[model samples]
Target: MRLSNRNNKPLFSFIYSLVGIIFILGVIAYVLEISKFDVFGKKAWILLAIPSLLFLLLYILGRPVFEYDSDGEALNFRNNHILYILARKDAKDEFPKYKLLKFNIINVFVFKRLYVYILSKKNHIVILKYDINYLSKKQIKDLKFSLNKVVKANKEIRHEHEDNTVAV
Candidate 1:
């Protein structure tokens, strides 16, 4: 199943709006600082502007144009111009297993964000946080399906191995 951000207009629009807001705020801050002749404030405003501009540019330029085949051969993210050749066998071996699952949906006051979490075997926790407002429904659904499948498959395989060992 190949999936890409080819037709996610809503996501694109949301991101554009966000970046636009950031840029507008930056510009306003810069103007205010300049009007007041505060060198430090102006510098800070410019610094803030940099990330907003970079994110906006990247969203426009690095939008996923292609996706990987189901066989996990290669991934062409951002654009078909950049190919990420994956050694499927080697990559699968590096997959992480979750020791525990615990998370809460918290709304971020600033960006209104929601995040997920998973506890690792090494006593470390992993957070699955992202700007969901900037993602299409299709993208979100596909990601959920993929993650569930991976977790299910991993659990089943582990159980099978354990059962086999016990029978020995």
Candidate 2:
């Protein structure tokens, strides 16, 4: 199964465009003599500051697109921002199902993340994180369901191995 929120790109773009247009219209109105409000002249800085602050707020709250693929023998997870320049390095991880140890989903404020724990070839535990802030509640539920299945399977497999092994 593959889950992704790439379709939201156009929606976000539209929102950004609308905000920009509103700011431009405010500037145009201020320049025209038709303006009578003192706020536009005496407090004109508010007009500029409002839009600038809005843009900054939106950028800070925006989250990267996330994808999870579990169709093949390995689980693939990817996180990348639509605007790559402001975003951190993209995160991508693929590991065999059998190596999965545990997984966790953490939510702090408006941000959400998925932490996948895997056993490395050197017998060390490796943790991979993927940003999942933009995912809907239903999508998050489905993700938890899928990861739970893997966790349960891993636990059973380990139990069988322990039972079959001889005392050291």
Most lDDT-accurate candidate: 2
Residue 113 in candidate 2, Cα distance off native in Å? 1.5
Q: What TM-score should be assigned to candidate 2?
A: 0.76
Query: Which lDDT tens digits does candidate 2 get at residues 51-127?
Result: 77776756665555888988878888988766654476788788888898998988988768888999999999999
- Please write out the lDDT profile of model 1 over residues 15-118, one tens digit for every residue: 55676677777777777677876877536666466857665554434323323223353211222312132111111111243432433433343232224455
Query: Which candidate wins on TM-score?
Result: 2
Q: Give the runs in model 1 whose Cα sits over 4 Å from its true position.
A: 6-70, 73-131
Can you give the TM-score per candidate against the true fold?
0.39, 0.76
Stretches off by above 4 angstroms in model 2 are 16-62
Clashes by residue pair, model 1? none
Please list the Cα RMSD from the true structure of every candidate, rounded to 1 decimal place. Answer: 9.5, 3.8
